[model samples]
Target: MASSALQVFGFTLGVLAWVGMIGTCASPEWRKNSHGQTLIDNTLKYEGLWVSCTAFVTGQTNCKDYAEFFVNLPQVLQICRALMISSIGTGFVAIIITVLGMKCVGLGSSNHIVKARIALLGGLLFGISGVLTGAAVSYYAQGVLQDYYNPSFAQGLTNVP
Candidate 1:
């Protein structure tokens, strides 16, 4: 009874994590202006994996997709993009495997041991997905920090907290 309960719990958590991965991928607030209340309070600048934008309190906003100038992009930005996408893909596969292996679903092997192994495999994939996400976010954060602190890099601008 306990084993089945654990499997259900793991599957639920994995699904939630997968959804979160997708949300993060779609979010445009990966980075934003450090000071929202600047002298030019009308404009707010922010950036994400795919695009960057500036917004005005008056409901005006302008955005631009990341340029295809891959060579000029920061290594951290490049790596983060790759890793974030990978995490989403891996998480998706894990979710499908987990669903098939679920005892209630009975879509795969009937043997308890086989089902358990499949669940374990899904769990492992979930773990890898989480690790990749952490690495990507951390690497990007490090770059933001370095740039923020270095006057020569950002001038008066700093990364959003």
Candidate 2:
């Protein structure tokens, strides 16, 4: 029972950590153009607000993939002990840190309509990626449960002596 409690707590904490990371990473400084509508808000480069969407798609690099970072840390830390949720915490912090970097580049002049359309497109992408990431994590956790926590997978069978 105690172990179960611990596991439950850890999993709950992990979920929170993941969401927090995404939120932090996704949010950018609310920078507004002369028109004052928030050209760069919450780390989103509103389309008509396309500061540099091309830079993103070139594929040579990606602006700190927040979701991937959040999703991969927990498993890696199992190899050691000091990490202790650092993976999760780091993910959240990383996005927060990088947003500042991206903003420093500054956006080019884009119309409000273009920015709104871009923001809408970005929202769609974010939704799809978020769902895919969540599903992947769920599948991973299920695998862990089945392989390690399931009694039938281990030596729970009783001896017929």
Q: Compare the candidates by TM-score and give the number of the best one.
A: 1
Off by over 4 Å in 2: 1-106, 148-152, 156-161
Clashing pairs in 2: 28-42, 28-43, 47-118, 47-119, 48-114, 48-115, 49-115
lDDT of 1 by residue, 1-161 (tens): 23667778988999899899888877888887655465685478888877788887777899888776345566776788899999999999999888877787769899877887887788899999999999988988887777777876665564332
Return the TM-score for each candidate structure. Answer: 0.86, 0.30
CA lDDT of each candidate? 0.81, 0.35
TM-score of 2: 0.30
lDDT for residue 21 in candidate 2, whole number 0-100: 40
Each prediction's total of clashing residue pairs, residues at least 3 apart in sequence or on different chains, is 0, 7
**For candidate 2, lDDT tens digit of each residue in 3-24?**
3355345334544656754443
Model 1 earns a TM-score of: 0.86
lDDT leader: 1
| RMSD score of candidate 1 (Å) | 3.1
| Model 2 Cα RMSD, 1 decimal | 24.8
